[model samples]
Target: MTTAPPVHRSHTAGNPDLLPLLGRTPLARIQADLPHPHPGFWAKLECLSAGGMKARAAMSMLSGARRRGELRPGAPVVESTSGTMGIGLAFAGQALGHPVILVGDCELEPSMRQLLRTYGARLELVDRPAPRGGWQAARIARLREVLARTDDAYWPDQYNNPDNPAGYLSLAAELIGRLDHLDVLVCSVGTGGHSAGLVGPLRRRWPRLKVIGVDSVGSAIFGQPARPRLMRGLGSSIHPRNVRHEAFDEVHWVGAAEAVDACRRLARSSFVSGGWSTGAVALVSAWAAGAAPGAVVATVFPDGPHRYLGTVYDDDFCRAHGLTATAPATRPLEIPHPRAAEASGWTRCRTVVDPLAAPRGEAPAPHIPAPGGAV
Candidate 1:
């Protein structure tokens, strides 16, 4: 009998391939059995990636590029990230035996810095962007200047790179397989990489799928005026070319307070530790799922809670930023006037108390500071 060919296992036993790493993230029915009157909403816990958030996909993209000769292996890899992406790149660079350098803004959290350092990446902090001209413009200029002075450095411009979107196609396929059908995909827009990347493939399969792009209230992305926002990793002060506007059926702008509350709720109820943007996206997902009956809402959780130790999770930082004090009997504050849409056709669910602009209504909910203030 023609016996089956002798099984020959690859050397990297128990090690997963790039495609597998890109998907099958823990899918939590965080909203199941809740009193919400919407279709089932699920969160693909990408924070469980080996590096966390977009890091796994980013690394896979870079590694694939190197294998295809798009990038030279062992070349010093340099890029700019607010946090999570840097850690991902650092992991990929180290694995591929490439030295990594990162350019970050001063606003980057200490925990993110520590993670990058642990991954052996050289960190360079640049000045915050110019207030009037746009922070991203200034930051990009700084990155270009750094690149000009550096030699043999590969710049993975996550903001404008096609690879940024290409890296997420596998995720789309995986989500499609897992959910069978997705009516809505909720994601927060930063560089627009994650949303843009997933939309293309998802649309090809589910042409009517609604892609809701969530931005922080102060983010200039989606053509809003630039303003300082307490929320990080979700909004941009400038429009990023990578954002696929056509792919989005609608957009929503979430504030920092609402996002923080959502984060706390997820932690308490589901034990899911999520970042600020992820919290904001979750809030939107919950809302959208409730708004549309029988809709399968899938949202992306970009990173874990470990990185926000100082700001979102810290008590002193919250008080300093006018956030609510954390109390033992604290409860999730309901969003007041949770139905204001901005001029850009995006809904603003919280009271608008813009210090730059006139206060529109009541103050935001009290922010409960985490005890011990350590991540």
Candidate 2:
């Protein structure tokens, strides 16, 4: 059995190579500098490592693989990634003396692509996103082909694997010790790893803690039908098995224009770079604090703005996509738009589960039939 690691309130003691690059991430509390009004608002920046919070998940997954003997020494570890997780796995593979092969779309940033190569991880670029399943399915298909060719290949299934969520025990513990009390946790959903990973232990400690999940407007994970989503690393077209449906108290959908505006505002205010989810979560967190005054609310910022300079921060890109400062409503409000309207703002959904969708107890995404099947 793969045992869960105990939560560590402090940083790892006596770490060997690259372990120091992993944990002890510091959290920041936001204030009046933000464009919106709020009580106590806090954001946890996960951009400490080159890999970000996914690095935390990577450590636990790789460690478990080593212990299980499922991962052979010098084996070529293969996985499908959009960005952060790929960089994280590369960080881990180098530390563990294993080679890594990252499969993703060819549009990966030059900096990130070079970093992966620098870590000695081979980058396999898929030509395009599958019309049905999107880039995720295309990447997974490539991973399967690679795995078939390599006998000593270990794939860290971040979505469905129990080890993925189990990885964030330390993150929860860190938050528990850092904050006097955390009443609300606003997290973005992607593969549903960090939200499920961090929120579970957090609610256990703070029983009344309200978890509000932030996702892209087009993501199907939170009862919405799958549509093309511009933001990466935050939403999924296919519902990930890692998403603890019952875990979330409510869900909020944020559009690209609003997200980009939030990112720009974040940088100007606190000099904080809160990447893609940062903006969405921050927008919701501001509203969350406003909705319930004096409640200490915290949100996880998956990564920083450096990766988004060409996109989120670039005025040209924003203009080209019809996403600009004036394009979105800066003020966070109590609006819930399912169709994703022109006004870039936050939309709250009280119905946590999709009424039209199947029950949560039913089959997982991997078991789902074609064109829309998830990894």
Candidate 3:
């Protein structure tokens, strides 16, 4: 029989009060018979944390800044976010006694806007996307403007911050404590914090651990062109430096309709599903579990579904976005390289490369084999 990991304050030396509310999120097993019969995947329900999974990253960044004197006592915290990171910063700000200011894009949901305000964060929205970087770059530009005027302000640049990924070490420990063996670890690539953070520690214990990264269809993260992306928690218009290109054994791109279908199906079948990132990660994880036979697979559900009610769960919203409950392909279409072709639906690539380092259509490095020399 398996036992739960022990509950404790955050490993960081931050405000003891809020740290205790952040860790020890529940790990659940989700089994489905759809398309085929195979072992189910384990999901770390990060939605159960006080703010969300990124809350851990928020606190870690803030505490590290304070300790290093980059952020003074009672300094204002400012950053750009799509949604989830904003909520995390708000929670961390309140706990650490810093006034929080967030810059988001117009596409941010109403529910998330109100929740951030309720958490005592001052929210700003960018009216339009930048010419090259989409909403993310626009929000960052506005964030810089806010920082220029605000005195003694600190910006925890989640995308490139080392502390952002370091915050997830505790999460890795929890997974290690619970699972005796793990074959595949699936993660949604957003700012690349949690995936980068978790893999190092996890691989130390299980050297042959397979890491699969899930991203949105239009994201530029895996050499795909940036398009207007409807999904929030995963994918990015600009590539983040934090993405450990060499760490992943394979990469999967999931479309909005596919994610929506996966999320609704998961809610009905397991009663414990999350938002966009969760849905995308789950879809890929289910496929991985099915293909690998008895291998143990695990994934993280970034946030709860409540904030996505106006978007992912609403019938009207789904219709407007042309989303439906259509099931995705049972197996992903395999590609030789990230730029082999533009992936529209569910697709996978074995040769993962850092787009910045390798020019387009360049031969990618050899695949990093998983256990038993299979990718």
Candidate 4:
């Protein structure tokens, strides 16, 4: 054997750079006894990313903007987010030499607020929900006000920007590299970037792949009536244009209590769990795996548990919100169409339709700024 060269230690403890660690998150097999006993499904542990899965989108959006000259060097980047995307944009801003300004609503978790500030992003809070749209609308409205004052500010409107989904192509490549074959893909619907972005490329290889979408019970994305939603990271009051309604083969609406139950179960059994979106997707994924024995079902856990300690992981918070650890039904109640009736709990619909296509006012239109120019 040849002799090895001597190793040397650097003066610094380690590299402070976090940009290089953005993707290729670990995929864990989740086969919990509580939800469904099957041959276990795989979960893309996106929570292990530097700032959750949306970090991929954020970096792509900003980098694309710079290449197209839409974003000047060192200019401020502004957008509206609930929590996850804020963390993503904050991380991307630092990586690309841009200052991020995020508009969030009053109900944003304290942990998320502190984390965004710590990342050097300026946070603006909207006081109340809009009469027509909701917190999402209120946040976007406030975002416009901030954009109006800042010079050369670029708004990578995650709700409508094509670049948002385009960013996720790398994630699709990662999945293909790891798994030999995939049957079904389960994803939580929010701005609809990841699901819409991923399915097209994945389908190119697995042409018969089935895409299952998970949304909040009160979300209007799948044609349910809009109500005050407690869960974040999935579901939307405003119908985001980024959502490709035709992409989903089936849709499932998951409630707060059911999500909480799955989250706790996954944490206990598999030792890997996340927040609302993670639990919601996991519940549906288990059912999908059970429905077709041997089918390779995969889901994405968007965020980790640390940010949800005060809400999803806290006993007092669960009690206050009437959430319980009771396990969800083995199978979801089915509906023929999205608007057959308003879903209140764990429900599924096979015929998915674009809510905006029904009528002019069926779904609330997003109040996003037009692209191509600064405010």
Q: After superposition, how far is residue 111 of candidate 4 from its true place, in Å?
A: 1.0
Q: Show model 4 residue runs off by greater than 4 Å.
A: 1-17, 325-327, 359-375
User: Which runs in model 3 stand beyond 4 Å of their true positions?
Assistant: 1-15, 33-37, 325-327, 360-375
Q: Please give the TM-score that candidate 2 achieves against the real structure.
A: 0.86
Tens-digit lDDT track of model 1 for 1-375:
122222221222222353344445778886732223345588988887766667655765676677678666456666777787887786666556667777788888777788798877877776667766455566667667666665556777888777777777767777878888889898888887888778888888888988887887667665445667777778887656788776776666766655676777777777885778877788778877877878888998888887877777776887786555432112122234323223211244333232233344645433333222221
How far off is model 3, as Cα RMSD?
8.5
**Alpha-carbon lDDT, every model:** 0.67, 0.75, 0.85, 0.85
lDDT tens readout by residue for model 3, 190-299: 99999999999999999999999999988999887788899997999998999998999999988777788778888888899878898888888888998888999999
Q: Extract clashing residue pairs from model 3.
A: none
> What local lDDT does model 1 show for residue 375?
18
Query: TM-score for each prediction?
Result: 0.78, 0.86, 0.91, 0.91
For candidate 1, the TM-score is 0.78
Off by over 4 Å in 1: 1-22, 32-40, 64-70, 132-135, 325-375
Name the lDDT value of residue 304 in candidate 3.
85
For residues 1-375, write the lDDT of model 4, one tens digit per residue.
122222121123222386788988998999995365777899999988887899999998988998999987778888999999999998888777777788898899988899999987888888899997899999988888777777788999999999999989988998998899999999999999999889999999899999999999889987877889999978999999999999999999988888888899999989999999999999999989988998999989998888889999999999898786444555677778776677767788899999888765454332221111111
